[model samples]
Target: MKNLLESPPDKLLTALRDILAAKSIVSPAEIAERIALTDAASPAQGARMVARAWTDPDYRALMLHDGAKAAEAAGIPMRGMPPLGVLADTPDLHHLVVCTLCSCYPRAVLGYPPFWFKSAAYRARAVRDPRGLLAEWGTVLPSHMKLTVVDSTADYRWMVLPLRPAGTEGFTEAQLAALVREGDMIGVTLPIASA
Candidate 1:
């Protein structure tokens, strides 16, 4: 018998899908559709949500209160995924997210996790010395600001709502979204206002 652990992920997924299909648990087409949906997802979805939250107090309240609903409201499907939690960065507080065991990310909003986000070094540094990690990413926060590191788990994932950049008061939502990036939503970097 082949060792399942050594099997490629695509092969494993195919085998699992075959088994589920055989059992009538879920059809192959359904699985393919779901995969397509996930593939279509990107950081832009999260950026849109962040921009909306920055410009709309009601949306911001909903995002902070229920991230999954916020994602759905932003038109990103959150069905059959772990719960999402949005951590809002404030002038005095910042949030850093990491999955200590694995790369448990908000894929429904942020698409695939970045390669660095799955690295052991990032996971260790994020929990051990988040400030240092941020510095390495060129995200230097104020010395007086408190940094909180949150763990994203299989049961619950996390995404950051970074503070809106200065000089963006009059920017349109699309413009604000343009300033946000995957790193910003992951809390490794902050959005910078374009001069």
Candidate 2:
């Protein structure tokens, strides 16, 4: 038959899909929609949430409690994606995120992973020596402060909520958001106030 002569990978994929559906694991339609959503997600969506949290204490608490619900409330598409875990950086503690197994980042919130994020070196270094890595990135924490490295996995993704910079008490939400960078959300860098 024509199907028999088709590529083995396609046949394998079809078989896998059928097995998954038969086992009631995940439907093929859901998978397709997830792929579409991933493609549609952008870093700007995450920046908006950060800006809102910076300005709204209630929203910040909600975000820290249930990141998925907060992100949905912010109008970011997360219909079929895994729940996002937001790690907030404080004066005495800092959070860093990395995917040791692979580049399992919060793509729906922070867009595509950077080149270094997917590199083997970064994956190993993040868990091994987070302070050193942060230092290399020009983020030197206080000697008494603590650094926490969080690992992201396939089923769950993580993002960082950087501390709002000082002397910007009057900055509007849009202006605050403009200062947020993709790296800041990923915990690789901090957001600096623009003059």
Candidate 3:
């Protein structure tokens, strides 16, 4: 028998997948479906939603009320995924998301969470010192604006709908989407208007 340890990582994974498929433990189609689902929840899709919200008040309302539904309406496949919550940053309020127990990010909208987002220090500081944490990330909110830190859970995840930056009045949805970054949706940073 060949030593499994001697096989390349990719080769070993492929071999295991083939064995599993042969044993009826899982199928190629199932794996492909899961991969497709995961790919659907990227930052680009989140940006598209944000751009739509900026252009349409109704969509903004729908997104804030029911994120999962809004995502579905925007053609993002979210079957069997947990409910999503969209938080909007108003002039007087800001929202931040973190999973206290673990990294329960809105993968469908933000893809994978950054390494720092999954760190123990970030989880604790995000709740205990949101202002400081935001400052560290170069996101300093107005003194009068309140900061709200929301915890993401297994059943409900959150995505931030950042306030549209000034000087974007004439920009198209695609252009606006270009300005939206993963950090902006995470509330760690705000989108800047391009000159």
Candidate 4:
């Protein structure tokens, strides 16, 4: 109370919420729940899908057709939303996702979004010209296949879900899953198994 009336702005705001919570105006659990929730599931989920796609053609088809159901079929619950869609990034094609107004993502498939996705530079230009944005990420796609860029507003969020490289054709699901990196899942890069 000593600092609330006459202190500078930063000091007034500092520790302000904690004070309010102590007074029972807002429970600590309430704030924790708000901050702890993520826009999507963790990136590990995407890696699993990609690995399954490489090994099982039927499972792959299911994922591409109905991603949400496919995820639950694989044991990851689709937190709240429905109609999950999986955008596959092929050898010649690339996919990137954005939400112009807000970050709408596939929490069950992709997981929490990276910090860069929320930045002003990414949000502004990703929709206007996605190819340029991919270039900034060092992602180059053949000009022939359309770069399918989806939007994840409140209604949807996306997972990049990278394609498996050629060398690992005989790899088991474990090995295959290892190659799908976070950047690959977000459409920034493709996973190339190291020699």
Off by over 4 Å in 3: 1-25
lDDT of 3 by residue, 1-195 (tens): 877798899989898999999999999999998988886668999999999999999999999999999999999988877899999999999999999999999888779898999999999999999999999998889899999999886689899999999999899999999999998998999999971
TM-scores for all candidates?
0.90, 0.81, 0.88, 0.74
Better of 1 and 3 by lDDT: 1
Whole-model lDDT per candidate? 0.92, 0.89, 0.91, 0.74
Using lDDT, give the best candidate's number.
1
Candidate 4, lDDT over the whole model? 0.74
Candidate 1: residue 172 Cα off by (Å): 1.1
Clashing pairs in 1: none
Candidate 3: worst 10 consecutive residues by lDDT? 33-42
Please give the ranking of all candidate structures by TM-score, highest first, separated by commas: 1, 3, 2, 4
At residue 99, candidate 3 shows an lDDT of 94
lDDT of 1 at 100: 89
Can you give the lDDT of residue 62 in candidate 3? 97
lDDT of 2 at 134: 88
- Candidates sorted by lDDT, descending order? 1, 3, 2, 4
Tell me how far candidate 4 lies from the true structure as C-alpha RMSD in angstroms: 4.9
